[model samples]
Target chain A: MTDAELLASCHTVFPGHKARTPAQMFAAMGAWCEEHGVAHDVYGSGALLQQFEQKIAALLGFESAVFCISGTMAQVTALRLACDDRASRLVALHPTSHILVHEKSNYQLLGHFDALQAGDRHRPWSVDDLAAIPDRLGAVAMEVPMREIGGQNPSWAELEAIKAHCRQRGAHLHMDGARLWEAAAGFKRTPRDVAAGFDSAYVSLYKGIGGLGGALLAGNGPFVARAAEWFRRQGGNVIHRSPYVVAAAMQFDQRLAAMPGYFARTEWLYGELRAHPLIKPNPAAPQANMLHLHLPVSRERALGIRNHLAAQHGIWLFSRASHAALEGTSVVEIYVGDNLLDMPDGAVREALTLFSSALAA
Target chain B: MTDAELLASCHTVFPGHKARTPAQMFAAMGAWCEEHGVAHDVYGSGALLQQFEQKIAALLGFESAVFCISGTMAQVTALRLACDDRASRLVALHPTSHILVHEKSNYQLLGHFDALQAGDRHRPWSVDDLAAIPDRLGAVAMEVPMREIGGQNPSWAELEAIKAHCRQRGAHLHMDGARLWEAAAGFKRTPRDVAAGFDSAYVSLYKGIGGLGGALLAGNGPFVARAAEWFRRQGGNVIHRSPYVVAAAMQFDQRLAAMPGYFARTEWLYGELRAHPLIKPNPAAPQANMLHLHLPVSRERALGIRNHLAAQHGIWLFSRASHAALEGTSVVEIYVGDNLLDMPDGAVREALTLFSSALAA
Candidate 1:
């Protein structure tokens, strides 16, 4: 059978979350809107989106918030405004930051910001790294639970020191908090607690929330007002944003409440896998709901084992494996969410054990 | 009662189209996706959006097409690409173009292009208007049936001459074809015929097709590939675009076929209104499925009459009136869509006659 057919037939998938079909998502959004008597937005203004934005702002301890079509637009607009306010076009980012890796250098190309690499790719930036930046920066962006090196975050004290350093340098501290929800759970702090000192923070609505897709950028009132203008300039201001707004509104609370559970599950799963000789997880422990598992096997062999598990064991694991930092090994990221939580106890561990044996063989 | 309560209670709305509640839009999208067995798109890829883009590209007689979240992004990206290709930052726009009037100067602030005014704001630009621009432009953007000027398009010969002028000046001719369907009906031409010779064109899927908001940019292969990159850079590349693609696909052909009828009704209605005193259309003729009615009444009086018609006559006409160029006159735009065409014969003319008499009083 084809890989897609095999995946479709799997009884359980140990990835980020249970994937909902598009039709199911739409139906759920419709039901929620009917129950709530939701109103449609016009060019990003309406009771639904405004109320949601306010709720998010309150949750994140901000004076205001604006919803955008994507996290890319929200963060870029935030950085652009920060840079414009400081009259310096320079910003500092980690080498593995989403702006540096995923966005095709739009922060430099479209936003016209000169970017300085602030830290190494394999670890989260510390206060010492922030002090080493030579230029007078307009802004410094930090991604909580940096995803590239497998969901590792700096200590709370480090984050605070970085914030203080930005204040001393007169640079805005912007949080690329796309996974801030997960990181907050790991820190045993509320989202507002984690977000308190940043000038601006952008959080993805769909990543952990399991909504359709959108983002929220939160800051003080004037900063958010500027973000609204940049939102329009970026074409994030569509005539009707009701679908995304409603989907996010419906799922946000429940999913956010479940983050701690997901994080706990990640810790358990990481512990179970770490006992196996063939598996080595980045960061050595779980800091969030996601991590990378490095296996001493070629990517092709890892894929074959994953496919074998899906076909014979009815368990879906990693989609693809990439080359790891070390020689002759491949790494796959496993993000624990509702999918892992919903699975019966020991099922995931057993499947991983089998896969590990196959890798060793 | 509030204006919204009154509007919600009305059976007819004669502006652009009947407003769909957010729930209804979602339900319709769900139904369409179910019938089509549509697959979801990821980051603007997948068969659903790909097939729709190819269909639009073929219809517009272009080598390829890219879908964007808004017409603003499509147009801006297209212009940015054209300017980059020519190694020049200068482009030309009409005084009342959406890029200038609506987008808050993003092309200048974000795209960093120098924009020169190409024509007057009160009318469609002609070939002489194109010739009058003194700069060696990177691109020239023209709106088909310019909406700000009451949906008036230049003659075919003038359009052809403008194309020739752009060619001689070595500038890319871009069409802001938001209402190209309506303009094609007025020109007695196919959409492909109307779009011929333009280096790139942007069309609004939601404007005429009655979809949830999205847009398409059509051009040759390399230009379109560049547009996709720009789409991602601008954050117009969202994760799940299936709802918009399915909605637009479901309605495109039917609405496109209905444009000629809508245009014909506009012509007949224009004739009936012009016969009455105190009412004058901008072009003195209906060029497409929309026109602006210049009434010899103050804006307040026009709104009062519109409310009277809505409350007493049960007919929804213009929502608001703007101050016309002439003293003591106001202009309201009437766009003929499915809502207008669904009305009984002469009903619109009779209501408009009452409005004219009210103005005369």
Candidate 2:
């Protein structure tokens, strides 16, 4: 079956899904375009894009914002702009930041930026880690809810301290705020307030909004203007960004308003999952709308159980199971989204019971 | 009125417009999605993208292709792969290459690739230019129908010599094939024949195809595969590219077939314009689907005439008037497209009369 058909066929309860069904996503985008009476962006900027950028910039309390094709471009381009003409193009971040692990070392390979790894693997970068960096850095990059490690984040005060240190040291601070929507909800602060700690921030449009993929790099006007140039050089300046921009604008409000609810449900669901004998919640309590669920089952058994759940009950769960698979433990990453919200009460308990029985098979 | 309404009202000829109406584009995309029975790409690869990539790779006679958000990313990423493990990250190209003039020096700034000028300002790079570089290099980038100099390109033999020189010197050859579709018809070469000269080539989707924006970096399997990883890190690995990919697929065949027709139309249009007392073709002969129409008029009056054409006769023409505007010479760049072909017979003569009258204003 086609991917769209497959996704539509399964009744999924996974939070990591950043998009709805393809048909639904496009339909809503078409509707949004009609209602706004706006044209698609020509080359990264137009009425639809301008409005989208303004809304995001205002939400994050930045002077300006530039839309890009992906968060990788946004972050790299932002850091590149930050390092412009600096004697040192050094940056420090948690070792697991997307650039370090997922980007194929582009910061060093393509961007020629040196990265200093800081902080422990299991936790967010602390103020002590920031203080430990001896050199003057071009920028300090941080990700909220550090997805690699169970969506845990530093307390707001801690994050603020890190921000202050970067400022005091003449280093530009950037936020890899791909999931800042959740961070804001978790910290109970406005997005602007959460983002105020950084000189610039890269917030994702696709993840929180659950729309077509794109990102916004926000900073001061000159910085954004410069980043816009880099955006083009780097190919992030796309033509006809209507689907990404308009649909993102449409979903922004609904998703932003729903973040607190998602956060609360995350806590509730984690609480529910913890009672299971074979299940354990990393972080125990979610800092945001996603966490990791470790189960005493093999990866093969977890895959069998997930497939069984989808086939028998029409319910799709996490994408895959990991975490010490050789030791017969299955780790599933859970993202709290509308999928989880759509589940009925005690649905998780029933699904876990089935999962428990399938582990033996 | 909105930009869409304004564009709808205009009945003029211009270059650089590839998108039809936003509604039409999305409708075509939606239709393609339905026919293909697939969804948009999630993160750079999926059913829709694979089909899109395969079609371009086959058309260009390359072993593989990776879709990117724009030509800049495709070129830079392609070169990084080309320059892999090389001591020299230096490239030689036309002095007016897009990355040099438009990218704010991103190849040097972000990509760390030093560039050396290798061609005359007014012509394509020749074997002499390659010999003049006087050093080992990473790659040699050449634009087909170099847009800045009124869409002029060297004969196939000249290009072959340059390609041979690069190969002889152990340097990679790259093509900024943004207008390769136009160039193929102009040179009476197959797309594959044109692309075969380069180790890696970046062809644009939105230009000739008249589709939503995206680009393809085409090369051998491993080069494109490595470029795909770089693509993700560079932020070109976006989610939900169905609208761009499918709409482009819809446009590709028809547009590719129409290039020769467009080239002939460009000659006809340029011939007609040359008969005007005040108008002159920059190259004196059409090289591709586009050319520069230089006029002995001020930029303001040229703009006024264009606006008059749109306001009075509903014709949209040219993006801007430049080339010594202060010296009262307005150069209007023209591209032959379906929009130009849709005009009535002898329409150019009639439009010139109106343009002359408007210039008098």
Candidate 3:
């Protein structure tokens, strides 16, 4: 058999033999520009990107939007702006929020924000968790379908209550909606429905949309006007964002439409896998397009089996299968993407059988 | 004359361009990639941008370097790193330094850097000027060839003394070398010679190099290592920077070679304009590729005459002919670029004759 034919039997994050390299992405953008006759957006001056921003803002039900290069910059700038008209610089976030854990508390370090941890790491915050904080808050930030913990999200009523509390406290509610697209599917609502409560929301352009790298902060006119200056000051204001804009706009429409299907597939996998004694899916339910698959092995053994499945069976799975806090068990987060749709109907069960057989061996 | 020919005959920032629109820039990058079989830089992953970075580091003689989306981010990150290893948060800068004046004190506001203004507005900082600051300083920032007043630089010996003074006071020396390429020609030295004494330096990619947008900060390995983390924290770290990388690399070689010529042309133009009674040149002697041309006209009148010349004589100057601190005299900063070189030999003399005669009337 040919090497290419042999590889076709295995599924990967990329399609068979077509890795999405930098040159490929750039070439795609160039092709996109020519096909659409897309005019270039010069140094944040083009109409195409502004239209992209408007489409996103409208989808999310925000009055205004400004694009960003990173979610860290977007969320940080949002929180800083929320605090601008307030006396308190104190902001509230979940303990496992990406900014608190990954970015070295840069909200306080670079953005001059004082962060207060609000929720438990194992679950999404409820109204009570936010109400327990004693002092006045400048802003309250919540990750929609928090990625670190099985992509769990609060119920609609619980979320609405938290938003109400923040408003009553004269604080802005900012959504760190990095995966808002998937989260909306879990809620069985349009993205606009999910974003209705927040004073400001930051949505990522890459994670769900698969753009180069960018995010957009959505808010009212005055809020975004204040935030744009900070965006410029932070050096996130690029001269030519057309490459990012074109790529993001092209994928945004396609992937956003497919999010519901990805979410359903994730739910189906979790349901099927939960019946096995050796296989455990966290939260006992799929909240979004992500699930934590717990294998009855150590983190190292789990990683080995994960790699083995890809190498031997050609059925690619998680790269980050890790040790669960529980003894003798490991976990991996499966974030469903468009690639998942390409797999055969029995792909998950078949993959699970191999995962279980390897651990047993 | 036809409108296109008439407009083309008058020089612009871009010779062939009515203006340098972003679409044209993007199309150029697309063409470059197709021509060179260039690869993409996915989240700073590709080697091509690093090759470009190495070229800059070697030219400036720094051990390590990192590219940033904006000079504002580069400088803020540099000063933050410089102060991290020390206790002092206070930084010394000229009163008119970009971070202070144009950015609206963002160094203090966004970066939390305390400002300690040093030196005179009219001239480059001397050893005496730096030695006069009493307090312990974390870092001292000087823009080589200060762009606002008139592109001016300290003599090599004077710069050395200022560097030594900063060293003796246990402060890091930071060079805001946004226009370092042109500044080197005025000093009659290499870029490495100019960057030798500073602990860290930043150079712009788009300003003189004609790239879309970006800047690079050069420093020692450890310093750059720390700054890189902040670069990510600040959201200046970009994925798919191939467009910027390709464009910047394409222009770097051509422009760096042409720096001396642009500087000389600026000096020549300044020398010719000084003889007129109503026309005046700031600093009396041209220092770099820029000078402030002062005329005995009000700001409003100067702007009207400036626009008239662009329309009538097919020679363009500036719209920022401002009311000088002195009454009745207006000043315009003339920043010489590649476009000026494209003008006819008699163009400057013709432009000057037109300018002086208008003021006289």
The CAPRI-style docking tier of model 2 reads: medium
Specify the poorest-scoring 10-residue window by lDDT in model 3 chain A.
A13-22
* Model 1 misplacement above 4 A: A1-5, B1-3
Clashing pairs in 3: A23-B40, A43-A239, B43-B239
lDDT of 1 at B113: 78
Identify the runs in model 2 with alpha carbons over 4 angstroms from their true place: A1-8, A16-19, A83-88, A134-138, A168-170, B1-6, B12-19, B85-87, B356-361
Model 2 pairs whose backbones collide: A15-A335, B11-B314, B11-B315, B11-B316, B12-B315, B12-B316, B13-B316
Q: Compose the digit string of candidate 3's lDDT tens values, residues A1-361.
A: 3332344455654221133544456657766776776765555766688898888888888889988877888888888878877978999989999888888667767756889998787889999998999988999988998888888888888988988888887888999999898899999999999999899998887777887678889999888878878887787777777767887887778788888888888877766776566877776788888877778888988867766666688876665667788787888777787676666767767777777778788
Q: Candidate 3: DockQ? A: 0.42
Query: What is candidate 1's lDDT per residue for A125-154, written digit by digit as tens?
Result: 989998987888999999998988889999
Candidate ranking under lDDT, highest first, comes to 1, 2, 3
Name the best candidate (by lDDT): 1
- By lDDT, the better pick of 1 and 3 is 1
